[model samples]
Target: MEYLIPFNRPFLTGKENEFVNEVFRTRNLSGNGPFTKKSQAFFENRFGFGKCLLTTSCTDALEMAAILIDIKPGDEVIVPSYTFVSSANPFILRGAKIVFIDSKNNHPSLDENQIESLITKKTKAIVVVHYAGTACNMELVMSIAAKYKLYVIEDAAQAIANNYSFSDKSKKFLGSFGHLATFSFHETKNISSGEGGLLVINDKTLVERAEIIWEKGTNRNAFFKGIVDKYNWVDVGSSFLPSELIAALLYSQLQSLDEIQKKRIAIWNQYKNGLKEWALLNDVEISYIPEYSGNNAHIFYLIFNTSEKRDNLILKLKNKGILSVFHYLSLHKSPYYKDKHDGRELVNSDRYSDCLLRLPLFVDLTEKEVTHIINIIVN
Candidate 1:
């Protein structure tokens, strides 16, 4: 069924075609070409990340993080239940036990306060997802990881340009806080390369090994750089790198990040202002951005009072030629993991699973379209 307003439309900067043409002219189509280098350099220079590697998708990036951390059988990695399966799949594939945590009461971010109690002798890492491009409490998360000597892998798939401000008046990008982090450039994300992702290495120790893993577990990258006489397989990995075409497309999007963010934030503010009274009256909750975190306006979701009401709203929007949708079901309660899950109930994660509704939000969505959505919701 087609709708006048779709749930999402991928936005393209006018320069994408030109950049791809440049890649063609250069005759380097595979990964780690000039375009890939430029793309990696952009993130590393802008965010001061130790190293960055473009991957086929965020899942691949997370997989690289898992490999870098050496997750083995019986190792437990704590993660929020209310997130995309990619967050947990990587570690699970390494035979690590995923200790699912609950979301915060007011936001979809993992509850940082409950993290310590979940840590056991088997715990090796804490993976945190910055939902809707907002920052999780990195200070608390990092302190806990430090105390326990655990690795922190941030699933910053939705948080590309988002930043976190500290009490010292310093600011850090969301992906920069973790020892390893991942970012997505899927069509649904703030930035798009059709399908692409980035792996950020903040812990300098992982940089060399990450490069090797990114190059199909070989020392090929070092060989190309004249550091190694001959490249050979030294570690376990897969083909995770994106082709140069994807990097070219992504670099084009990165060039327009500021303009895209400006439009999105404006749309977000309009929704907030328009629906404030209605949300209050209806007892619905809007997406919450903490003071320390900078909003990139990646997503604008509403938490309805009940699942029935939420479902009704989706149907109503559909009837009106609009498209709104819901996000992740609790992974702990997922069919594949339900029986495997321990008997502990994650209250907030379940609540979000039942009630959170994501409205149409994209760089191309106009104010008129946004107002139309708000009118349907408020009325």
Candidate 2:
């Protein structure tokens, strides 16, 4: 029997060990250390983001975004039903009502065209997740938000370093367009720090408050910069920062972003080429990359003709030693949210939940392994 090929695995290159060793030598493993500052600076400079705050996980960043926005009970936040629960969980935790929207027919992002119809007087914000590292139509979403005076929070968990281009040839990095954005550095992502994430604040007005909330409602960030003589609790908040050890690991990953991305893109292209014939013959559809968007090849998922075929394919792939998987179950259909659903049917989201399957994609997957996996699927 062959060795088991895991679904997703982290890849480390460059200075991970050296940086981590440096952290240990310094004896300062807590947050807001030298590495943390360096990592934050790296994000701001490379991604053209206004500000960046490293956190324990993408969930923590989203929670921070929720608190920064002051989400209140009865306030509604529009989000896609096709994303991980963490995307919507923060708003729910804040007692804000969730308005689940469907995805576009060809992609796993919130259908921007359907957004306007869902907006109401109670809608305070719109959360757009860049599913599988493919960006949503930010221009349209931003336009709608501006017209309705709503805030836009980007759940960019899977979109670190992903770039998007517009029809007019203009381009923007995924995390730069939103009022606030969140990124993940979990082991499952392209980058890994065991468990970590970052929050990017594009709205200058929210920067100071975000830092306060990040430091457990204290103006310690200010105090540290000599702007304040002392720090004390000034608002309701929590500790969202990660230790310098995690920052050290992430910095290593960030330093090699280009090389890691190149390898992943190669694997993504191999899968597409290898599966094209099988997909066509089976009447299935593969993922599409819009001309206006440059994806990071973060994930490669295919859509089968029916839910039954998708399930059978998973079993077949597993039997053949290829471990493929499905994605999020629509949030609106979950027991926790069923009663809360606003009676709107998210048809596209349901379709995605039923039919999509993610193939093995990661930085370290060898060409021969990829070929073997593709052969199993194609056969």
lDDT of 1 at 374: 94
Clashing pairs in 2: none
Model 2 regions more than 4 Å off = 1-3
> Clashes in candidate 1: how many?
0
lDDT of 2 at 153: 96
Estimate, for each residue in 296-332, the C-alpha lDDT of model 2 and write its tens digit: 9889999987999999989888887778899999999
TM-score (C-alpha, index-matched) for candidate 1:
0.99
lDDT of each: 0.94, 0.92
How do the residues 1-379 of candidate 1 rate in per-residue lDDT, one tens digit apiece? 9989999999989999899999899889999998899999999998888799999999999999999999999999999999999999999999999999999999999999999999999999999999999999999999999999999999999998889999988998889989999999999999999999999999998999999999889999999999999999998888999999999999999999899999999999998999989999989998899989999999999998799999999999999999999999999999999998997999999999899999999888889999989998888
Each model's TM-score, in the order given?
0.99, 0.98
